[model samples]
Target: MGDEQIDAAALQSWLRAFARSVAEHKATLTALDAEIGDADHGANMDRGMTAVVAELDATEPGTTPAALLKKAGMTLVRTVGGASGPLYGTLFLRMAPAAGTADSVDAGTFAKALGAGVEGVVARGKAELEDKTMIDALTPAVEALEAGLAAGDSLQEALRAASAAADAGRDATIPLVARKGRASYLGERSIGHQDPGATSAALLVAAAASTLGVVVGG
Candidate 1:
């Protein structure tokens, strides 16, 4: 079996779906954040994604995956505020060069890029598992993607596995005590609430499954 390639259109669709998901769940994210940190995750992400879409619309990076992802990363870094801006921005930034200039990217390449992106986030945030942060969801999702690939799954199947793992990681955050970021400030108070960042990370994974995987699967 060979790597599953996704074209520029597929990448665009993935970004669009993620933006839409963030917008649609803005209130929910904010409410979740309010439980342990500042109640602005939703607003920040919504604004950031809106800006990213607008940037993409105006620039239209065309078929170059590296160009598109780099532009997206820069836009996020410039437009988005808070920890998400840097973390998500770093994700795309690291992924951009990793994706190279291919007209389309294979599943293995995509997973490698995603892994690099997660590493970027970890470097920037200095977060670890059970930290009640986005890393909680992202780490498991990446692991699932790798496991799926090792099992000879296609890109769609791998993404599906990743999404499920991300969801599970998000759910698992509910009972965890905060150990990083703003959530850590709450101490025992953060135990019962789900981490907003983890929830949003799951949304991003789900977006990939809904858009990228669906396109590949179809």
Candidate 2:
């Protein structure tokens, strides 16, 4: 676990941790995508994150989380292949502006920035509820984070809520026929398998929870 502050160091660590998680689950992600997609989600993401980590290692991104995240987004855009590169790159890019110039952000600000990130993904992907996309997991998690923040929960508690919501949303995608992406080409055939994007998105949110010391489902 790391410090609770949403600072540059913490954000960098978050990206690194996420990269590791994606690598660890690469096979599962590709397997899920193989059921209805190009089956390259895992390889593409792994390669991109590897580049991100390398860039992070090579640069001294100062102390601003915004700058760090922006650079990370660009790295993904340049290195990652497939539609995932643009979608994920846009996510971090939007978050970068929301993060502002602050070295650290409070829970409220962090939630707002995260919400902005998800909105970017939605805009870029044009996905909606029950679409069987990453939006399914991301939207619910952002909503839950906001709800928890509104209810005055601690950052950890709010993250836990977000993570749990993301997990539920991921599970919900299991029975849905994808209405977007390559999976949509499968039509009715997509219903039985879980969405690769949604599953990976869940892992991302869970990584945040764990990195920030939130006890997911606790």
Candidate 3:
């Protein structure tokens, strides 16, 4: 997939897909939040994405991948509060460097760039997989992308694998006791509840797969 093949339209479409998915699942996301954080992750993310959609429409940032991501990052930082704000902000900020001026990225480049974003989250939050955080879902998704690429899979196939891995990772968090973030404060109480971050992270990956036309597994 050359740069010409993946244009600004595709990037904007991805963002729109993400915003729509999150908004559609706001109640479910909030329910997950009720088990962990301030029970506002869904509402906060919805608010932030709503602003992003508005910005995209108002600015019409066509074909400028870096600028679009930067705009999205700034919106999240301003609209979302608590850990999600800074963490997600950093993810998109780091991703902007990789996206550069391209209209769309190829499979390998997109996977590597996404890995960079996930690494930023790990560094910013100091969380690891199975720590009952978003890391669990995101890490597996990145790894799956890398693996798919190594096997010479198509971008859509790779993303489908990534989304499935993310879902599995999210489910795996159910029985684990939280070892990081506010959920950690619950001690054993966190054992029965799914991590909100992990749930949202899975949704993020699912959004990616959907936007890219990947046939994600159940």
Candidate 4:
């Protein structure tokens, strides 16, 4: 936000903000997972993001956004527990290349990069809409972001729409039977409970909206 650039520092802030959100919601996330998973999503996410922040702080400020994002991905893969580590890591790793080599990127570029990341999650997790996974949140948010931009909305407006879509997606998962992850083992039993992964993914979008808003001139 200081310089209105979606550069390395901005990306670093995004990760840090996400980590803080994870910490704040850790208990709720864990509770949700306890109903259908190993009850570790919150802890794993918090640990991974903590590591990501540490690594980012140790790196130089002049680093490009792509490098910063990729480093965050690797940190998550190394520090996070469970399948979520790889899946979330893939999201950032895929985004790195899509973000290109620029020191900063425009809102449209960020949208494309974010979409690429979501696709990575989809491919790595092999999950689709209504699968009751993080895909439930990420897919709709990305689609909404793109749609907002296509409609010529400001970046902040697009982000708002994305966040809303993510929240709705998270809530919608409450009625779905999980088709992936440990929750899938529960079959129909997985229904009627909000997906932990989807919930956390919604936080991710919300964090982005909060952290990127000022930078994009919201």
RMSD, one per candidate, in order:
1.5, 3.3, 3.3, 2.3
Q: What tens digits encode model 4's per-residue C-alpha lDDT throughout 34-150? A: 999999999999999989988987998689999998998998999995899999999999999999999998788899999999999988989989999999999999999889888
Residue pairs in clash, model 3? 6-104
Model 3 misplaced regions, further than 4 Å? 1-5, 213-218
**TM-scores of the candidates in the order shown:** 0.95, 0.94, 0.92, 0.95
Model 2 Cα shift for residue 207 (angstroms): 0.8
Write the residue-wise lDDT of candidate 3 on 1-218 in tens digits.
21123445655777888889889989998898887767888898888888888988877645476777788888988989788887887777778888767666666667777888899999999998789998999999999988987887777778889999999999999999999888788898888888888888898898888776443461
Least accurate 10 contiguous residues by lDDT in model 1: 209-218
Whole-model lDDT, model 3: 0.81
* lDDT against true structure, model 2: 0.87
Stretches > 4 Å off in candidate 1: 61-63, 215-218
Q: What lDDT score is found at residue 70 in candidate 4?
A: 93
Cα lDDT of model 2 by residue, 21-136, tens digit: 99999999999999999999999899989998998898675658888888889998998868899988998999989988987876777888889999999999999989999999
Higher-lDDT candidate of 1 and 2: 1
1 against 2, candidate with superior TM-score: 1
User: Which regions of candidate 4 deviate over 4 angstroms?
Assistant: 1-5, 215-218
Error (Å) of candidate 2 at residue 49 is 1.0
lDDT agreement of model 1 with the native: 0.89
Candidate 1 lDDT tens digits, 1-218? 32667777778888999999999999999999988999999999999999988877876445587778887888888887789899999999999888978788888888899999999999999999998899999999999998898889877888998999999999999999999888888899999999999999999999999877564333
Q: For model 4, where is the 10-residue window of minimal lDDT?
A: 1-10
In order of listing, the candidates' clash counts read 0, 0, 1, 0
